[model samples]
Target: MAQKRSIFEEVGTNEVSKPAPQGGLIEKGRKGARKGIRAWLVVIFALVMTMIAVGGLTRLTDSGLSITEWKPVTGAVPPMNEAAWVAEFEKYQQIPEYVLQNEGMSLSEFKSIYWWEWGHRQLGRVIGLVWALGYAGFALARKVPTGWHKRLLFIGVLGGLQGAIGWWMVSSGLVGERLDVASYRLATHLGLAFVILGFIAWYVFLLGRSEAELLQARRNKDAKLFSMSTGMLHFAFLQILLGALVAGIDAGRGYTDWPLMGGQVLPPDPFYIEPLWRNFFENPALVQFIHRVAGYLLFAFGVVTWLKGRKSANKATAGAFNLMGALLFFQVVLGIVTVLHGAPLALGLAHQLGAVALFVAISRARFLSQFPKSQSVREGL
Candidate 1:
């Protein structure tokens, strides 16, 4: 028999050749400047938070109905002269809010609220412009990630929808005997804002790491913790919508008592409104009561979620949950303080910011659950 060549031996030139090494993670490398994209997203996120704060202040100041018109393009130029200001003020005088509430409000007083609403709309325009320029620049440069084009596009779509919804909300207060926008419409506007904020936050989290790394990390995901955090997120969103309802009718100011409404477990005339459904949105007592109960339930659920997150093997995830829990506690306390103080501008804004912080905390915790970072035993145990 002929001698058999060992596998390592170069038996002959005719031996089968190995194919060139196929691309490995080439797609991931081509994902564009993820860090750069993340920074851009962070900027947008901050602006959205600012928008929310400004919107809250506008509502609190009762400045939302001051504009009396939705001149998206031309309104950018505020009244520059006495004649212009007088013309704008005349339009405002025709609104039900002015007729019923501020029957003989002076021109100077009208200017105070006019500036607030104008600034709010102007900020919206700025946000739109920033998004457009950034998106166009990245897209033209071919720097946007392969799959992120649509994701980025969605933010602008929501922004446009939010504008329309804003107009719809304001239109409700301009006519009829109504002094404010429909509570549900206000809820819808605020809810959409949160949704937009949530998406930007999630996209930000995803962009923090490479696609390949994310895929690998996802394999070891703590499904249970993720599920719990998701529930917390949904509950928090519900609470936010309830808050909008409260603000819509000044329910927060209606009940300045804590742990009780009108000195009882529930308001006495909770259902005084003719239509039972109307009570939930119109009756200050019922709306505030629902908001208080929901707050308690949300805090309880958040505690349970935090406990579950603490048991995670990943140290970073545990820390994130810790932060989330702390913020949740702080928010609960702030809510009480806001109620006790009758939701004054300072306390109300603080409480709103607290909600924002808690929302972000829970979001980060939930994301960490799905894509945990590396944790060595030598690291904080």
Candidate 2:
């Protein structure tokens, strides 16, 4: 055997262990945690999607304003006794919605709407608690890899902001000449929820693709793929915003037919309401028409995106593209069904959930396309 060497003795330069590149330690730990966190994020994202769907139900049922106050802490427990329930109902009776729209509403009637709003608020509270606890546990346990801690914290902040915006939305309805929330404020609140959902979906996709560089390390192919995928996501977001506008104005109540709205491609009077721009946000017919048109356009774009992506050799790119195509098809079908059914509660809620799923698909595709697998890196490994 060779002579025993001292701990610090130079074993020949070539025999010495090489230090890993810059992000090596972080990357090493990242691989193990990536799958776990990706799964967690996906589950959390699904929960958020469900929350949004429930919110859509609340809005569709006109139950969102039933709760007259926002007591963030106490509100979570709900009204537990008859006296408490009466107090809550009495407060709602003073609101414009009750005075102008639901006058003579009985206690039982009040409870119907109150339960929906209460459930909505309760869901929000639970989501906040879950996010805080999960994020704190992950951070303290060092379960999340390096770059993701900041992002997880940011998501928590957005969730808090969502709570504030939800109250802001409610306050809009509680005061002023109108008994309903301002359409713009409603749109803004819903839009922000979608934004948060999109971020979570995209981040989860990125985590899943962390070990793959089949696209990013390759300049030309990857850049074009990323561009196309990102464009799809942008269109998805735009369509969701348009959907929110439709929901805000109660647009689904009109044009109860498929393929045509009152026998015209465009409503007979698109901007018959107030200022011309107001039609886009206030006129139910026009809002519904625009939403329908946007759906068609989004479907077309999604199909085109899928077709283009199919030309790529990357499996993730191809898979994501196919998923998007399927989701868009399902969404279009659901939209038509919802319309034909006169926007029945169940169908409308399903359509809303479909939209969220489609958005997630588009976001996932974009993320994966942006970070495809790399052959060079694979060979080295």
Candidate 3:
């Protein structure tokens, strides 16, 4: 009964809109756009940085083995009363550190060192809790970017392993005649900390831009600068591990001289320690000497990398590298001062902090080399 349509009329001109084809390209823009995650990571980054500084202080103060136990949960609630504190001190007394080094320490003195170690562990616990809460909140709210699930997961795993490794390091000194944690184990623990820090940094960089922007920037990536910076990064990390070794043995307090070790170009009895290889780890003079030589080499390489960075057309990228160069110089000066002062608690902590800043600076420059942001100047209008 409806009027017949005209012969020229279009058929079904208004097509039905099917629900967004069920994924694929339709989901690309909607996925992985959580910018807040980057800020959260930055918070965690700052906390970890502070943790490292506190750890340096703990080592310098000789408070590392105060707890003598790894009660991860129960340890968080410190002794609330004098009796409890005495109980804690009794436990510490059983450890070799207290027996050998702190045999005559009073309960008050024991409490001082105990607090330092306790705070260090408490900081670790806080960091882990922060990561757990943030990751959970983000995942539950569906805010995490695509491809980041595993990356975040890996960090959590590393943190757990780090706790275990920390206990392992502590356990090393609890038995035997050792006065402190094994130098090798300390280096391992510190190296993993840096590794975790580096990953967080790289993640923050990636989250700084949209996926599309990163893809576009990749097209103009400076291969040469990136390559050199990568080398610089590896070299710097190696230097960090070496520095940890020096710290483990209190090597910086060994030779207060700059150009020489107690007036000799090489440290006296550099290989006097037994087992040959043990000298590198246990000998303060040798460890400090190796650290100095490694620093020189690292600085030279940084110079070469900085030169390459200067050639970048992106102003920001070039500036990043220039800053790195300045930090390298500053860090060197700090290290020299730290050594001259016999690695006093304050100066040692400052020097360690300088290393942290320099490492972060180089990392930033390396990132810019890979994803340089172009600067546009208007032509003569």
Clash count list over all predictions? 0, 7, 0
Superposed model 2: Cα runs more than 4 Å off: 1-26, 29-32, 209-221, 374-381
- lDDT for 3 (candidate 3): 75
Best by TM-score: 1
TM-score of each: 0.93, 0.87, 0.91
For candidate 1, give the lDDT: 0.91
lDDT, candidates in the order shown:
0.91, 0.81, 0.88
Candidate 1 pairs with clashing backbones: none
> Model 2: per-residue lDDT, tens digit, 1-381?
887778998668557677776755545766547777777777778778878988998998899999878899987787889998899899998888998999999999999988888888888888888788787777777788767888888888998999999999889899866768887888888888898898888777677565434234445356776787788888878888888877876788788877889987777888898778888888889888888888888888778888988776777667877988898899999889888878888887888888888887887677666665554545433
lDDT, candidate 1, 165-191, per-residue tens? 999999999999999999999999989
Model 2 poorest ten-residue lDDT run: 211-220
How far is 188's C-alpha from truth in model 2 (Å)? 1.4
Cα distance off (Å), candidate 1, residue 370: 0.6
Q: Over the full model, what C-alpha lDDT does candidate 2 score relative to the true structure?
A: 0.81
Of candidates 3 and 1, the better by TM-score: 1
lDDT score at residue 116, model 2, on the 0-100 scale: 88
Q: What is the lDDT of residue 373 in candidate 3?
A: 82
Better of 2 and 3 by lDDT: 3
